[model samples]
Target: MDWQKNLLIAAIIAVLFMLVIRWNDFQESLPAANAPVSSAQQTDFNASSDAATAGDIPSLPGTTQAVPVANSTSTNVIKVVTDSLVIEIDPQGGDIVHVALPRHYDALNTPDVPFVLLDNRDHHTYVAQSGLIGANGTDSAAGRPLFTSAQTEYRLADGENQLNVDLVFQQGQTTITKRFVFTRNEYLVNVDYLIDNRSDSVWSGNLYGQIKRDSQSFHKVSALEMNPFLGAAITTNDENYKKLTFKDLNESEFRTVKQGGWVAMVQHYFVSAWVPDANQENNYHLRRIGNQDIYLLGFTGPRVEVAAGSTGSLSTSFYAGPKDTERLAEISRYLDLTVDYGWLWWIAKPLFWLLKFIHSFVNNWGLAIIGLTLVVKAVFFHLSATSYRSMARMRKLAPKLADLKERYGDDRQKMSQEMMKLYKTEKVNPLGGCLPILVQMPVFLALYWTLMESVELRHSPFFLWITDLSVKDPYFVLPLIMGLTMWLQMKLNPTPPDPMQARIMQLMPVVFTFLFLWFPAGLVLYWVTNNTLGILQQWYITRQIEKADTTA
Candidate 1:
């Protein structure tokens, strides 16, 4: 019975882990929509020529535009350095060509190369582009405006909290000021379009912010690890977070009008989002560029009228950085949803709060995880105690059950009836331990995701040899120890009479150890701590049961 219960638990966990790993495959196999983009759609987003007129611009808003002004490796990049970020802005389309986090390294050991989020490299193209798109606007024509910047390089000065990089586009008396405002220690940058209508009665146009990216994975994961989602997501009136895949873009164009919302490109650990004015009515759209794997997620704001001899402005903040839940929440509503914890967010949120609180005192993330696990176990102590007591009673009835089995021989029905009689006489519930473990599965899964998705745990050190909690242990120590404790827990329960069940019970720990060897060290730590606690409680309960039997 004990062997069967342990086998079942092991099987359930393995199935769940595999299901999560294959989730993306399931999504990719879904059928495409009827109106998939044709070759004609690719021409709509073709690269604009240098000599271009307004006719080249598409009538539809939020259309994907090729980077026609400059190609990758061109000497036309404007680099700006802030306290927390290194950015490269291209004047051709006034696009953010490159963004790197100076505070975070690309890998655990590589301290020199920062994590590059957005770049215009030959192999990859992920840039944030924004400009005016109407009468007298910068990008109103098919040809992107080649604005001139005052300086090619700018760095945040000492004690400076704000920096501005202004690209000026002037045609006679009409001037369009494309200003990029960056703040110290913040990832949000203000992209503003200032329209100075000097020789006009009323200049009418719309401002657009878009992120263009090729289908490329930012981080390459191992076989056992699940790749983070790489696609577009938007917040709408009905749904808090709606994921728009590349396939979805190819199938058909999507447009939604909302008073306040956001459009974003998400990846593992990091996200880049456009948060517009909450009171402004904006149209959000997604589309694919022809057969090329290029996709765009963007927003077009309401038309603005810049009166004669007056200056008008439309602005939105672009957040490009790590998916810090607190920081993203401060930027916009439901923005923290980018740090996806799956359908278990309700449990993961509180679990994160507890882990964060514990880390405040312990000053070590590994210790904080251990502390949180202990607290969770303590909260369910009584329920677990009842389960252990029932198991102990069952173990005490093993001799009688064995006698019934011998008497019934091949008669399975009579054996089951005798076993039920003995169970009723002793008031022992066979499924008590299993029910308690099942109840705790959601908590376990939530905590697992919390450990996996938390960027704070990335490259964090625990103790000797456990340098990075976000990655697998180099020596596979924690997982091996976890396997040992699981085996010890099995030993505390009554041995199964069935040889096949006993063999399965003997092998489950080994199977789990192999699976966990590639798992993150932080997750393995949580499991190891949990299994050790369970073994201690079960050992104590078994001792108490034997003492009672000897007294009787």
Candidate 2:
């Protein structure tokens, strides 16, 4: 009976523990509401020009004026299609204005519609911008240099491994070629500025890359669901990874210099980052545009000087795609941290790896979750057996405890003392059951994050009506099964001596069922599998203990 009370306390503590973590992220994920734009702000945000002011760009040592914005005119837009991506680049500044993932659909019902990541449409504004700034730079306060491309559209042909799209800008005796190199089945695009300066004087400029976006969430989150982080993340010299929310940027500008670290705009399951040359020192910055909801996260490389009659190039890699941990890791150091498993990433990483390994063989995410649950239970079998044995001993002593309660009806202190004596004589620890649950809390939380943060689970299907593992179960079947299994597991444990406590313990299953109804189906399936396995294990242990007592 005391063990049951401890079990209830443990369950409540576990829920509170997870809530504490989720609440912090939810607060950070809350973007400032889309504020009404003033007349001047409206003009600055005009969809037609889409140009950046000089203040929007990072300045060089001697150059006060900096970056320019790309014009969104149809004549300046170039469309490029590959196996995995459909992208729109504006030749005005050779900036990537829009990106759609052809492999990842916008919604389950729309099979042919691709998920748009970066868009410069009227409703939302998010785009990747890059340019050269400083003395002799083509981009200035006046306007961005308009480049010309051979064609307005390009498609990666079958059997082609790479596609190159080039935009050329020419000024007296100087030619600048902006080239984008895309590889098949890859999301990283190589952006290079090839400068040929035949002028008498040396040409000097600093290459800067940035992501500009409005502080508005693209995904719709329900009240019951945990809001994922939607902000900017970067790597620094002192810290491997750091996140800057739009609120933080609004409060104060963030500036740091590191030896070729990355800056990225991160969302639910996708990220876009600018990874500069690792060998060079770069300056990273994050700030909100003048009283507007717009935020910029970018980096400025050191100034490059091309001698007269010589040729030189500056290069940076831009990644826009799903948060694939392995691929991100290959792109840059600590870039995979964008996957964001919270503070317990050490535990989550291994769990994700095991799940992926299981999925590889089973070929189903649902089955992999079940297998992962089984493996976790197996790993904790000994500790669980210890707890169940203690619970079984308590169940055997339930009759004596009731008799003692009846004898000392109104003596609370006396009852407590006698209960302690009885527990001691029976060699049973009332707190034993709580240890197993407390010890397993981290693993449970890690699994929750793994299911939530993994892009592989998005739009993945289980059997029947569960078409999306990342979303709630359409039929609520898995959550109901989870509740049933939880109830069965509770039945295996000893009933509490107090009527109120017993009722409270009985209500846990119902409350959890309602709470889990809106949870992702994959997570609900895991709970069902775990509760069922626990029920079987506890039932077997209790039966063995009772049979031994009967023999005695």
Candidate 3:
């Protein structure tokens, strides 16, 4: 009779689950809204140009082989190759036109083609641009200097650990030499402007660094999918990390004053940032560039006055690479915040640290996730022990509880009273299993986000069949195993007196299995490991309680 009741309840819940799934599918089938429209930037660069009286200062040259007004033809590109990076610079304004990471690829299976971080081709305008602005500077309202380099190609030779690409622009008696210094195994490039004020008059100006990007997603995401942030981020005096969306920049401009901070454009797994000298006061700005979908995040350095016949250099570091928190933290304060662990950062950070430590020894990310789950289970062992023991005691008294319920079958109020009295006398809590789960839910969610968002696990593989931990299990093996363990854990607990409650319990494993089928394999592996461990502990405690009861 109880089995009949359970079957009825299961059937009803299954119908409800099907309805929910259908509703989600229907919603996803709908058309998406239009993309954010472009708008013109409303900046006061003209006023600044007028005040500095450097309106004749040269603006940056176009990197996409844009025709110049002077010749309407010539274009120059300088190529630089290093151990880990390949970059292209346009001498027109000394802008970094293209950057590709040799160690990373464009896709999971594409090894020959490297991952490109910056480019100015195929209608995609993403590049790093910087130059001195204000008085006596090359960047001005009038024009931008087109620099001349000795060669068009340079490479980091064998046995060499550093390389320098220099471009120079001479205007009247003043000479501006822009040097881009690259190290063998580093993504941070030293972009320095050495201004030789050979002229009798003093030279004065400010340096500006900016990242310009259009509104095209580098990695395509579905409309109903949950995607990582793709926008502008800045470190401020008030907050460690602040995000300004492309839509936000389009609506209004953003400006702030900070002595030390960074302005960056962040995407799914990579970021490009302009980190100024910490000792200098800089003004940070975020705005959409003139009626296009392009947006700019940049900083203006403090005004500098170089004495006549003296050379003064203004330098800043630009990092364009993967979001490796450990390396980013060394570059600037709060730069690691770009990793973005969400509101659960406190829990996620420690979990990631422990996970990484485990991987150091095991040398496998999948095993590291299992080790992490075991550690979390051990930490909550005492609370879980208490909860499981309570449930075990209740399970031991299930026959008596069933007898009581049968005696008061027609009297609902009286049955409840008797159940409470029985729970008090036996010192058993029917709801004990819920509290520990509630306590650990946040930790579980944190670990999920940690695994899903960490780029280190982007294409990491485990044992057979699990190729990418950051995406779903290819054959649904892990999720099915997780569901099986969950069902076993349920078997060790007392059966619910209510047919509806029992039915819901039975359906939970199936529901969870369906939901986790799309979750990352790493996350599902954690769940399966945790559930298996819990089942073992609960089964052991249940057996011990039954033995003691029989002996007593």
Candidate 4:
């Protein structure tokens, strides 16, 4: 294909890819979620804290709670943290509070508190239930059948609740130990699995690690405000972001998606869990928080056929943390490649890289986003110059192109051919303006994903009102600037001969402005900065080229 056609195809391909992805998003809304809730269950949860009454609290997810630790203090040994991740492990149950964000919040404005209680440490979730892991809901949505039973075994002699958090299953001949470790600040959550096969003959079966229940915090609103975006979309019993998918092995009956693979379930949020292969072929299931169709995202590694009287062990990690951009870039090549977010990275990453540079200066993510924006404007002054010049040159050449067309009459092919010849004779690259615009696309996308998917950007702020860059622009200031910059850019560029097309193009700034109002502030900032740079570039190019032509 001609370079121009190829460029056009590339642009169209990028746009189409974006559209198809959005459609695919609707086609597969997060996997089937648990049942919303029963009227009776809602009534019970609303009554009061189970601290006052026994049996009032729901049971933990899978196993019946073990006998409550005899010591009262140890029952709530987990100290609530406000500044950072603090893990307090004693024999009794543990409390895991990601006190990173605010404890109190308005569901609409503020992001949810980021915390996943493996088992409600203090049983606030399952009030009065002292022993055995209880189920969150009657159905599959409450979370997979997770059996979390704790005993204050005498091994580690700290007498808190005398609790040892152990999630395992033991039958006569086979024992499965899936959960045994404590907390993780970053990277991965390690799980130790010991399978003992005591049968006289060889015993072979596939072990499994299934996500029974994953949850999201919701705003307890009145019956008036019940939307799925808020609450309406969930099932009767399962309301949070939860899913149940099988271990991905050689399950041919199930269709597998190639793009996301095993990590499909994880995006900006954190998710890592480990389980041994459970050969219960029928046990593969996939579920999400709001949808109803079950789909599986799992891995079935090697098959197991163990001889009699032998023990086997499997080790795995559960990653339930934020997705850091640079850290993930190094984590795997797939992660780095997937960072293609959109055009914003052309502006955001340099800001991040510069901030990382000055993070050498003053290590704060908030400051870095600010600093990054500043450095981007400085480095690309020349491109901005050329971009503006090209646009202005087109402006200068438009009247000529129009006169040539008018003289040529309605013969479009002849006129276009003449126009090209004239442009060449006059040393004008009719298509010179497109290259810079196209090259910036991938860089912009990469930064977009970096900002959206990175945990470092999560909860980080750039002053008041512009708190979270990951969510929609709060005050609309950034989006407005973006629109204004585009208008300025258009003012500097050559106008299309078709007045109607020009009018439509004139409206593009506003359309894009409104579209971006829902986008994160950081993204809008990048775009505004980029457009401003392009105008400067085009202006510079026009002046330089004109000078040489006049001298010639």
Per-residue CA lDDT of candidate 2, range 1-552, in tens?
Answer: 455456667677577667446644443343323445567756656732344333566666444534444433455689999998999998877889999999999999998999989987654679998998878777676677888999999999999999999999997899999999999999999999999999998999889999988877856666667788989999998889999888899899898999988999999889999999999999888887667667889998998999999999999999999999999999999999999999899999999999999999999999999999999999999998998888788777879888988987588678878888999998888778767877888898889899999999999999989999999999899999998998887777777676766787798899889888888899999989888888889999998988998999
> Candidate 1: where is the Cα deviation over 4 Å?
1-74
Per-residue alpha-carbon lDDT of model 3 for 1-552, expressed as tens digits? 344345546555554453233224111232222233223211333232222222212232221211222211125689999988999998878889899998878767887888899987534568898888766767654456789999999999999999988999997888889999999899999999998998899899888898877766745444423456779999888888999888898899788889979999888778999999999998887876545566778888887889999999999999999889899999999999898888889999999999999999999999999999999999999999988998788777789878987998778778878888888998877667656666787788788778866888987899888888888888999989999998888888878777677778888889888878877899999999999889989988888887898899
**Candidate number achieving the greatest lDDT relative to the actual structure:** 2
List TM-scores for all candidates, in order: 0.90, 0.93, 0.85, 0.59
* Model 1 whole-model lDDT (C-alpha atoms): 0.79
Q: For candidate 1, write residues 1-552 as lDDT tens digits.
A: 444446666756665564355435422322222224455653443432111222223334545543433323346789999978999988877889899998888888898878888886534568887877766666643467778989999999999999999999885687888999999999999998888879758888788888888775645466566666779999998899888878788899788888878999998788999899989999887777655667778888888888989988888989999989999998889999988888899999999989999999999999999999899999988888888888778677768777876888588667767777877888887777667877887888888788888989988999999999998999999989989998887777765555565677788788888878878899999999999898888888888888988999
The number of the candidate with the highest TM-score is 2
Judged by whole-model lDDT over C-alpha atoms, candidate 4 comes out at: 0.44
Model 2 Cα RMSD, 1 decimal: 3.3
- In angstroms, what RMSD does candidate 3 have relative to the true structure? 7.3
Runs in model 3 deviating more than 4 A are: 1-75, 222-225, 400-411
**Number of the candidate with higher TM-score, 1 or 3:** 1
How high is the lDDT of residue 446 in model 3? 80
| TM-score, cand. 1 vs. native | 0.90
Q: Please list the residue runs of candidate 4 whose C-alpha ends up more than 4 Å from where it truly belongs after superposition.
A: 1-112, 116-179, 193-207, 213-264, 275-314, 325-387, 409-414, 540-552
Report how far off residue 259 is in candidate 4 (Å).
20
